[model samples]
Target: MSDTPQDSRRRYSAPVVDGVNKSAGRAMLRAVGFTDDDFRKPQVGIASTWSQVTPCNSHIDELAEVACQGADQAGGKGVIFNTITISDGIANGTEGMKYSLVSREVIADSIETVAACEGFDGLVAIGGCDKNMPGCLMGMARLNRPSVFVYGGTILPGDGHTDIVSVFEAVGAHAKGELSLIEVKQIEETAIPGPGACGGMYTANTMASAIEALGMSLPGSSAQNAVSNDKRADCAAAGAAVLELLAQDIKPSDIMTRAAFENAITLVIALGGSTNAVLHLIAMANTVGVALTLEDFTRLGKGVPVLADLRPSGHYMMSELVAIGGIQPLMKTLLEAGLLHGECLTVTGQTLADNLAGVAPYAAGQDIIRPLDNPIKPESHLRILYGNLAPEGAVAKITGKEGTRFAGTARVFGSEEEAQARILDGTVVAGDVLVIRYEGPRGGPGMREMLSPTSAIMGRGLGNDVALITDGRFSGGSHGFVVGHITPEAFDGGPLALVQDGDPIVIDAVADRIELQVDDQELERRRRAWQQPPPRYRRGVLAKYARTVSSASTGAVTDLPDTD
Candidate 1:
């Protein structure tokens, strides 16, 4: 009395394959290696974000094939599809970086479009870069399918503990005369050794860990090396796990609950993850129909502490952490400390507590993750701040080493390019608060990450001396006294637009406020004078994104209610 094959697994596939009216569809699938036996099986879409455009995702083609093999072995039909990916490392400072965040929307749209069009019942998305991870999750959430996300895995460290950030900082070092052009060239040549995401707890690794904690990815999936046997094994297991998920009828909606998102936030805090986690997590939650907000980060961050000493703020790379058992042990530690929700459902078809029950603790003499009693920071380094300058709130990564307070004169620039020029030429010096505006979601039409300028600031030896506030955002590798995702971005005439050169800007992390020290009357006068700039791109993806994207405070998603 077991369920028949058609009754058991062919919920969506039967309609596409079993009906005579759908002969064309079956015939087309047959050309792609679909047999009569394959027609009876459930279809699992394998979304591959593989390209040679960057080392971050160059190896994903192999991982996608492994996943397809896994599905085929597990009595499911696997169909592979390709999605577009943009390299943040390659696009960091130029106008091309404007497409970086836009690529997330494109990836999500493509995945959802293909899966739905082809009637995929379950999904396995393989992603390597920062946006690819979230884009996959968002697509799966929108589909409400039994989906599994696989991190493309952290890259191996470059020579000399270097990475993409090292290369970026080296450029600044050369500009500052700290290093010769040859030294900069040496770092640029050696920093990216092979295919994988940038080798740090940067956005790629950060989002991977966040997705796992959110229960959308397999345990230990975030910690493996991109080219290793373990990553291949993980990809295969993820494909097979989708069939198990389909059997249990557990979809992303069942896993990406509000409490589950809290677990993600908790882990993100404990690991000292990227500030991009703030933007991407909120966007993922929105896609899943979960009620998450910037304030949630503030609330969850108060109790959680930063334990990982990973770069760009600390001494180690994700590979080193992986060497000591990845984040599994750290997750177990957080679970025991009562910081994580033990009952949250994960992709394993078990509670998060169940997954951690068998996880062994980190080996002795490991300093990668600090003991809870003596944490890297007593609370989360990701501080959500609010004031006149950012009435809708902003995010700051203050590891306490930068001091909790910064009061300086504003060195205003209309764009990141302008700021970078000044910083490279030494026109931007210590105690100057660099205000790079009009680079927000609508303004930049993509909300670009400010890694180059921030790296330059650090490279110029002004890491602790200067501060940067941007309406745009920062890379996971960006550190120092930096604040980003300032709401009501300058394009929308937020307070960031009213500021002029020499204006006093105060960032108080201790109190969680960023104030522009101008009287209301004077601000109103400047506001009256401010004029909204013409759209940067008259037509194309950037223009469309500018037309539809929401505020950064609301995750900068494109599908929100049109308030305009």
Candidate 2:
């Protein structure tokens, strides 16, 4: 609100860096390498979610240095900082995985704490894990400061094509006597070649691309390889871009409008992105006070087509798509076709149309990204279904490879571990709908992803023949006939807790309903007798989250009501 850019820049940072009265702040800054010249420039916090926990973020230290260089070169004093991260891959299928989703809130809180206390004028946040991208965006939205988000970049596939998804499926094959233990061991060894996110349209890449679509990241920044010069260049550009954001006072909320969120959702549909995006986008939008509901995603997906033939449900990897150029070409196709809103604001201080004005489409004969005339799927691969089972809503990825409808007898498991034990033991067979309840947000107390069970089903050659429904969620690498995020969760006494073995369940994508085919009278009787279970955790962060977190349909956020 100041008259001059310099005055506005000092509105926050000057309290710590510019005043003689605040000598203690300057002393602390001097201890950390801040000089007189540095004190004269606007302080920009460079937050890096770098850790050796997983390959996804291991390489971000070098990128942080690149960002500092960018900021210093652009006349801003960049101070690099670190935050906590957890490896979803390392913790998958274990009790520890309960902390994966919890890490998102911690990251946002810590980043906000550092910025607010340090009194930085702007921010450049870099994240690589499944949760880090959205966490950073949430912090930025809350801060409402000039900011830019940078993706660390997607990882390369092992042995050129097969990756961690292959390794997960290999365990199922070994269980079914389709793959030798030696071969499965080899797959585990070569699945991850180096540092980056799981090399597919998994959660990391999905959120990365989604952030770009949200106009928080630089153009074409989501698809570059993690170890490439282009990724470094993009990181540097983001650092410089944040200074521009500060100069123009272009805050994230300025670019993150309702139409902008729609543009991001449209891109997710085209990419056949992860179901987690539905949850994360809602939480992020809620930070900036945007009303993003499951119905909104369902409506926006109606006009978009699944044009990218990338992994999990498709036959391509992110690396392959990168070889033929990245998301820009595909975005250009959607923008020109009028599927995307071209007038939406971007991080570049230009309209989406301005960014795409000189962009080119994917080269001819590149089967990685299909043509507009002949798309992989006419409608979005992601679907939201509601019925007796999920009155609030549930997410399903129907890639068209898995038919539009599935009707089968339910095989109930009260927990994911129980379901996995049965699935790996060959007890889960075809023509069955596996029900894993009591694993939703308040149920599992974190709503773990079922990658192990889903991969096992695929490896056993039953990916298309069977279906799995859960109140929890799935990894981005999970495919086949699957439905997740059922609400209200079983712990809160939704219909899922009432499901018994042999009950006929139907998941009809064509009708957009996931139903439990029992009489209304019987359902009412069961509900009368059903009782909520005791809390799985009675202490610590997970317990706190279980207590405060809301339904999955509302983004599983822990914030107070928005009635304000």
Best by lDDT: 1
Q: Flag regions of model 1 displaced more than 4 Å.
A: 1-4, 561-564
**Candidate 1 lDDT tens digits, 207-307:** 99999999888999999999999999999999999999999999999999999999999999998899999999999999988979999999998999999
Error at 64, model 1, angstroms: 0.4
Global lDDT of each model? 0.93, 0.89
lDDT of 2 by residue, 1-564 (tens): 123346667568887766567788889989999887787777889999999999999999999999988988998889999998999888888999988888888888889999999998899999999999999999888899999999898888887478888988999999999999998888888889998888889888899888888888889888899999999999888889888888888998899999889988988888889999999999999888898999998898888888888898888889888899889888888888988889989999998889988888777788987887888999887899999999999999899998999999999998888988898899999899999998888989899999989999999999888999999999999999999999989999999999989999999997899999999999999999999999999999999999988888988888747576
Model 2 has an lDDT value of 0.89
TM-score for each candidate, following the candidate numbering: 0.98, 0.98
Q: How many Å off is the CA of 268 in candidate 1?
A: 0.7
**Clash-forming residue pairs, model 2:** 55-196, 56-196
Q: For model 1, what is the alpha-carbon lDDT of residue 374?
A: 93
